[model samples]
Target: MLSPFDAHIDAELAQAVATIAHLRRALEETSTPGEAEEVLDLFEKLLRDLERVKPTVIGRTRQHGASWDAVGRSIGMNKDAARKKYNTNNVQRALARIQDGRPATPHPQRAPVHP
Candidate 1:
């Protein structure tokens, strides 16, 4: 089983990815500013938490991000675990790309639309 720190890092990374995905989708569809702000808030928090976790690895936990799966699976995670972990890095990169006015991945969960 992976240590608590590893698990914590993986969770934080996953949340970051999912949040980014959502925000990206919202921007593409011209979502309302209020909804976009909500996702942005969550995304910002995830980024901050990720920076905190990045330096928490004290030993073999320092392996590449690919190692996040085994750590997650040991804690009952599923296939999305791996994809989600890598997406964390991808999320940040994609965000940068979008900020630079480039295309990014379409998010599966976009912010709710109002009538």
Candidate 2:
């Protein structure tokens, strides 16, 4: 059984997915340039939000013993790609958080096992 926190997160994710689907359909059906641009703007905002959240989520996963290979598998990418894409941003953001006196995600206590 899912914990309450997990359930709430799952529900929110589902709702967000549903909303995205609705927006995609509306975008596809748009006939006028202005309407299409409006839909595209909303889509761009969603993409921006995802970009902002991605590094933090990656950092959280690392703190919780997730490996780059595992995370890559989950997202359909290779570990090298994952690192190349996010590691610098992750380090920079973490440093900024620390400098700001905020508790950033903790680093893994042990190195990940290699296969």
Candidate 3:
């Protein structure tokens, strides 16, 4: 499934698109190279912002209800692609131990096993 970073990137991509649209409108109204360049730079920064957030989604995609399918939807990912990329993607090693058809929530009293 899609990761947390993937989810975040999905959200950021929408924001980036909106930001670009706004800048485009502004550019058409003003038609200044300097201003256009400035907006383009901001666009680049948003792209970088997207880059930074994708990894966070990727790192947090598995847990309880945080299944691959859920992760993929959050990140606008196709199910097959998300599965292909992250099927073996491990989230919490501790969670793996309790995978015998058990609930995934962790209780502090029930200490996690050290691998």
Candidate 4:
């Protein structure tokens, strides 16, 4: 069965696509290479930030009740891949923090995943 988190992810992805489309339009209207380059650089930075935060986002979503299946569909993967990639030791630490009533720390962008 489909999960509600999948719907949320779909909506977010749609919004992201719309935002990128608008950015592309603005980029095409830039009159100078310098201006276009600046926009391009910012766009690339945004993508990098998104990639960096993806694992944290997925972990937090799971903490808040999203299933791996939903997360996998959201990112175009399967359940096992999603958990294998995102639910590493860092996530466990974060989850423990929440359970122990401590503020969550910023997780490293990636952690070693164990079988």
Q: Note the Cα lDDT for every prediction shown.
A: 0.54, 0.62, 0.55, 0.64
Kindly provide the TM-score of model 4 when superposed on the true structure, using C-alpha atoms. 0.52
Residue-level lDDT of model 3, residues 19-67, one tens digit each, is 7787777667666666666566656655665554444445554534476
**TM-score for each of the candidates:** 0.39, 0.51, 0.41, 0.52
* Candidate 2 segments exceeding 4 Å error: 1-32, 88-115
lDDT digits (tens) for residues 8-50 of candidate 1: 5566578778878876776676567776666666666556655
Task: For candidate 2, report its TM-score.
Answer: 0.51
Off by over 4 Å in 1: 58-115
Q: Model 3: which residue pairs collide?
A: 1-68, 3-57, 3-58, 4-57, 4-58, 5-54, 5-56, 5-57, 5-58
Give model 2 RMSD, 1 decimal: 13.5
Between candidates 3 and 4, the one scoring higher on lDDT is 4
| Best-to-worst ranking by TM-score | 4, 2, 3, 1
- Native-referenced Cα lDDT, model 1: 0.54
Ranking by lDDT: 4, 2, 3, 1
Number of the candidate with higher TM-score, 1 or 4: 4
The alpha-carbon deviation from the true structure for residue 107 of candidate 4, after best TM-score superposition, in angstroms, is 16
lDDT of 2 at 17: 78
lDDT of 4: 0.64
Enumerate residue pairs that collide in model 1: none
Winner by TM-score between candidate 4 and candidate 3? 4
Q: In model 3, where do residues sit more than 4 Å from their true spots?
A: 1-31, 63-65, 86-115
Candidate 2, 26-111: lDDT as tens digits: 78889977666657666764554444445656665665689999878877899999877768576567546645755445333333
